[model samples]
Target chain A: MRDAYHDELRALTGRLVEMTRLVRSAMSRATTALLDSDLPLAESVISRDKDVNQLCEEIETSIFGLMATQQPVAVDLRTVITALRMAADLERMGDLAVHVAKIARMRHPDSAVPAEIRDSILEMGQIAERLVTKTGSCILTQNAELAQELEQDDDHMDRLHRRLFRMLLSESWEHGIEPAIDITLIGRYYERYADHAVRVAQDVVYMVTGSRVGE
Target chain B: MRDAYHDELRALTGRLVEMTRLVRSAMSRATTALLDSDLPLAESVISRDKDVNQLCEEIETSIFGLMATQQPVAVDLRTVITALRMAADLERMGDLAVHVAKIARMRHPDSAVPAEIRDSILEMGQIAERLVTKTGSCILTQNAELAQELEQDDDHMDRLHRRLFRMLLSESWEHGIEPAIDITLIGRYYERYADHAVRVAQDVVYMVTGSRVGE
Candidate 1:
């Protein structure tokens, strides 16, 4: 019985890593769709969010089952509870990606990225993907050091986020209000995606070390 | 020992309700700050958020202690877990309010809401406070019926959110890009605040009925 319980806990970790992979893909494709104005790609990102939601639900169910039967104690209990928090963060990351995709759909056939701001948005997207990838690795490897790396990536994301605003507010901005609004929201989506990814990494650190990062 | 466990559970509910009250006050003052350009009020809202965070930490510590000592099963297990989820949602709502407060601080001495869109923003703030008030009641009473009301309030918030964008994009919008950007982010903060409140209510419903609403 104890062996099965540990196996179930391992399976829970596997599912969380899977969630990170899906969210990463969603963010990657959503970025492409935004930059290229590919309607189909945007639609795919939006539709596949359900898969992330389902995985989160599965994780919750398994954690509840584990708690009810095994009554996980000490580090094991911390692991399951931390898994629940990580899954929630990962699910929100998926939603943030969809929010980005929806911007692509809203402005279909017209790329949301203005020429001057394109590089910033592209960098933000790249940072988002990098953060989530690291988040996945952190969850799978339980590497507290790798988790520490996510904070630096999140700082880079924040710098890119501020740069995007600078571009928007610069005197050279010719994109007008509509695109500015889109970019403001799109920048927000990427920043929030990075934040959630960082949160998942934090949860991993907490699970492994039983201590929170930066807290 | 069982009686002590149940008392802790009741205390958990009290803490959640206290969180809701803190979040509600935060939003209320945040809205006034945004509308009145009240820097002190905004600063107050921002500083008070740590209080909310501290309460959440206390709740988590108490829940962990309860789970370890009692090994609560079945409905009690669900109750403790749901309380954790509700605390998280409430904490996020506090952050969202702080986001709104920050916008007010950013534009201090100049109101963030333009005169034309002021009413809609005010209404959004009112709805946010209402939703959280009901959320507090739902947690205290475990009233599934009252929990259902939060969905309708959230729908109203969504409608107001849409209305905000329409005003910003309208031909008569004379505020230009800077204020438009501020309003865009302000609108998003309130919308997300409402979404979190609704989630708390949903968790309350699930805690009471052992089922989810709108799922």
Candidate 2:
């Protein structure tokens, strides 16, 4: 029975890593769809979000079941709770990707990003993808230090976000109100996507260290 | 001992209601600050968010302690888990309110909502407050049916959000790209605040009826 409990606990961690990978894929595909005006790719990302959600639900149930049956104590209990929080963050990351995809779908055949900001959005997308991929690695390895490093990585995304905002708010912006709204929201979406990844990484840090190191 | 456990459970519900009230006040003050260019009020809202966070931490600790000590089963176990989810939702709601307040602070001495869209923004704020107030009542009463009603109230906020978008996207929109971005984000902050309240209400519905009523 004890061996079975540990197996299930390891499975919970594996499931979290799987969800992170799925979120990474969704964000990467959504970014590509946004950049290329690829409606099919956007639709694919949007539809695949359900899979992420289902996995989150499954992981959550498994976490609860482990706690109830195994009565995990000390670090084991914290691990289960932190995984629950990480699953929520990953699920939101998936939803953010879906939001990006829906924007692409909404502007089908036309890039949601204006040409002037497309380069910056592309960079932001790459940063988001990298951050999410790093998040998966952090989960798989339980590397708290590496997980803490994602915040510095997020600083790069923040700089890009500010740059995007500067361009939008510049006096010469001529994209009109509609594109302005789209750029503002899309920039925010990517920033927020990175934010959730950072959050998940923070939880990983806490889970491993048993200390609240990030705010 | 069982009676003490039940009392602690009631106290957990009370703490959730208190957190909801804090979030409601934060949104209200943040809106007023935005509308009136009141930097002081905005600062106050921003500072108060810590109180909400602290409450969430306390409530979460209480929940884990309750579960670990009581080993609650069946409905009691579900109640504890649902409360945990609600605390998270409430904390995020507080953060959304802080985001609104920060926007007000960032645009100090100038209203964030342009005159034309100010009315719609104000309406969204009111709807957000109303929804959160209803969420508190739902928790206190465990009214699954009333909790379900907050979504309809959310529909009202959604329409207001759409109306704000139309105004921003209109050909006659004279607000510059900066104000447009500000309005778009501010509108989203309020919309998300309402969305969180709806989530709490849905959790209440689930806690009461043991039915997954909303997605």
Candidate 3:
């Protein structure tokens, strides 16, 4: 029975890793769709978001069942709770990717990013992808050190976000209001995507170290 | 023993109400700070956010204890889980209020919203306060109907958001990039504040109806 309980806990971690992978794929594809203005790819990402949502619900239900049956305590209890939180973060990241895909779909043949800030947005997307990939690795390997690295990775995205804002706010900005709004929202979407990755990594740190990150 | 479990459940509900009150106060004071450029008031809101964060942690810890000791299931289990989610939403709302207050502090002695969009922001603030109040009342009373009303209330804020964006993007916009960025972020903060309210309300709906909302 004890081994079975541990097995269930391991299964929970496996589900989280699976969620991380799906979310990573969603963001990578969504970024591509945004940059290439590929409507088909955008639609695919948007639709797959439902799959992520479904997976989250499944994980949440499994968590409740595990907690009730195994009655895990101490580190084991924390692990279950952290898995719940990580699943939520991953689900939200998937939703953010869907938002990115929708932007791509909305603009259709034209990229959501204006030409001036296109390179910056591309860089932001790359940072977001890198952040989530690291998040996946941290979860799979239980490498608290790699989880800590995600914080520094997020800083790079923050800098990119500020630079994007600077370009938009510059007096030389010639894009019309529509493009400005698009850029602002899209930039925000990517920034938030990175933030969720950091949150997942932080939760992993708490799970492994038994102390909240930065506190 | 069963009665004691129920009592503990009631206590959990009370903590949620307390969180609601704290988040409501934070939003109202932060809005005032923003509109008045009151540096002291902004600082207060920022500092008090930690109080909200602490409360959420306490509540979460208490919840884990209850679940582990009581082994609740069915409706009781769902209630605890939903409270957990609500506490998170409330904590996030408090953080959003801090974001608003920070913007105000950063541009102290000058309002974040330009004159043209100030009224709209003020209106958004009021709407946010109203939504949260209703959310609190719904939780206290278990009024699922009132909880459902928050969705429509959030729609009002959405329309206000769109209108504010229109003002910033207008050809006649003369507020320049700095003010435009400020207005954009402030507007988003209010919008997101309302979104959290809706999420809390939706959680309430699920608790009462045994159905996820808008299915």
The most accurate candidate by TM-score is 1
Weakest 10 consecutive residues, lDDT, candidate 2 chain B? B67-76
Q: Write the per-residue lDDT of candidate 1 for residues A95-130, one digit (tens) a residue.
A: 999999999999998988898888888899899999
Report the error of model 3 at residue B27, Å: 1.3
**Model 2 regions lying over 4 Å from their true place:** none
Supply DockQ values for each candidate. Answer: 0.84, 0.67, 0.47
Candidate 2 is graded, for docking, as medium
After superposition, the stretches of candidate 3 with alpha carbons farther than 4 Å from their true spots are: B1-4
Instruction: State the C-alpha lDDT per candidate.
Output: 0.93, 0.89, 0.86
The clash count of every prediction, one per candidate, is: 0, 0, 0
Interface RMSD of each: 0.7, 1.5, 2.5
Interface RMSD of 1: 0.7
TM-score of chain A of each: 0.98, 0.97, 0.96
The CA lDDT at A140 in model 3 is 83
Cα lDDT tens digits for candidate 3, B82-117: 888899999999999999999999999988867778
lDDT of 1 by residue, B157-186 (tens): 999999999999999998788999999999
The TM-scores of all predictions, comma-separated, are 0.99, 0.98, 0.94
Q: In model 3 chain A, which range of ten residues has the least summed lDDT?
A: A175-184
